[model samples]
Target: MELTERQKRIIQIVKENEPISADNIAKHLYLSKPTLRTDLTILTMTGILDARPKVGYFFAGQNFEPLLFEDLYEKSISEIMVPPVVIKKEATINDAVTMLFMHDVGTLYVTENQVLLGIISRKDLLRSTISNTSINKVPVAMIMTRMPNVVTLQEDERILDAGYKIIQHQIDSLPVISKDNPALVIGKVSKTVVLKHFIDEAMHLKK
Candidate 1:
């Protein structure tokens, strides 16, 4: 989605002093809270920013290593990743529930023949089960977010750039795919993992 000039400006401001509150952002930008909230919501949905319920929004940070971007850009997503937990399209809601709990994940990519088809998130499962008669009877595909337009980062992209994408897109995670085989998922970059590294680096730099 194309961001307006104002939206772009807002992103810049937030990136500079992140983990900042909406009210503060609004004050700084001279915008109304409602307008800022709308923009933030859109940005968050697009995976450009991370908005915690009370913690506010923050730009994803990176380790303080003084290495040049080139030093990190050549690395592939496979170098820093965890195996993805996926569910099949034919899987039942019960199966999704089980996998979600077992994997300790809020979302699961649905795949068939090793190709991504959709995503089933905790919210999706909850909504389905809550409004349905048989949670175990329903196929996950019935409620899964289909063909979720995925964003991928090259293995060699700077980690900081990945963080920026997360902030810019307002997404909690990104699927890292090989540049050669874009359809083949290699790994995921989660907000939790990125934030941990960033916070650790910041703390270390303070010493």
Candidate 2:
């Protein structure tokens, strides 16, 4: 789980002055002890800080690092991925556009005979519509980011792997391909999905 800025500051203060009282920590931050009650509780509960009866908080020496890395980042993509919005290769640009809005997705996967072919995004459809008046007649395949060019994830890949590619490539989403058959598309992962997963997990753990 990620910590708030105030929580990080609390940890730093405790490290510099171990066994310091809650009142002293609050004084260092120019805040009241009451205001820091929840922060202190979370830090201690997560094992990042240790508290004694009459003593105070101390850094727990990275006891929570393994929980954050192993339980959260190392999770498989299949655990959080959702079904992809797909279209056939023969579908027109108009059809692709309609499907995009209907499903409220950033990108649409194009396939032929249940095999992956390419991807169409809002940018692609916009470009095609601006140049051609006959959007109904133009096939989406005419202007799609095709296979070998489209970046994708496998079901067995870790969430950390997907997160890195999403940031590195600067893309909003990725289609998940089947491990048994690379040609088949199975699921979808997006920025929203990743953020939701982290937030939900964090909230659940907090409770």
Best model per TM-score: 2
Q: Give the per-residue lDDT of model 1 (tens digit) for 1-207.
A: 246687677778879888888898899988878666656754664446678888888764432232322233223445555667788888899989999999888778887766767777788888887898787788898887665466656666656567667776776667666678667666677777655654554465469
> In model 2, where is the ten-residue run with the lowest total lDDT?
62-71
**Candidate 1 to truth, TM:** 0.61
Residue 65 displacement (Å), model 2: 2.7
For residues 1-207, could you state the per-residue lDDT of candidate 2 as single tens digits?
567799989999999999989999999999999778767865775578999979988898855565765556679999999998999988999999999899998999998876889999888888898999999998899989999999999999988788778876888899999999989999999989987987777787779
Model 2 accuracy (lDDT, Cα): 0.86
TM-score per model over all chains = 0.61, 0.70
- For candidate 2, what's the RMSD? 9.9
User: Which one wins on lDDT?
Assistant: 2
Clashes of each: 14, 0
Q: Per-model C-alpha lDDT, please?
A: 0.69, 0.86
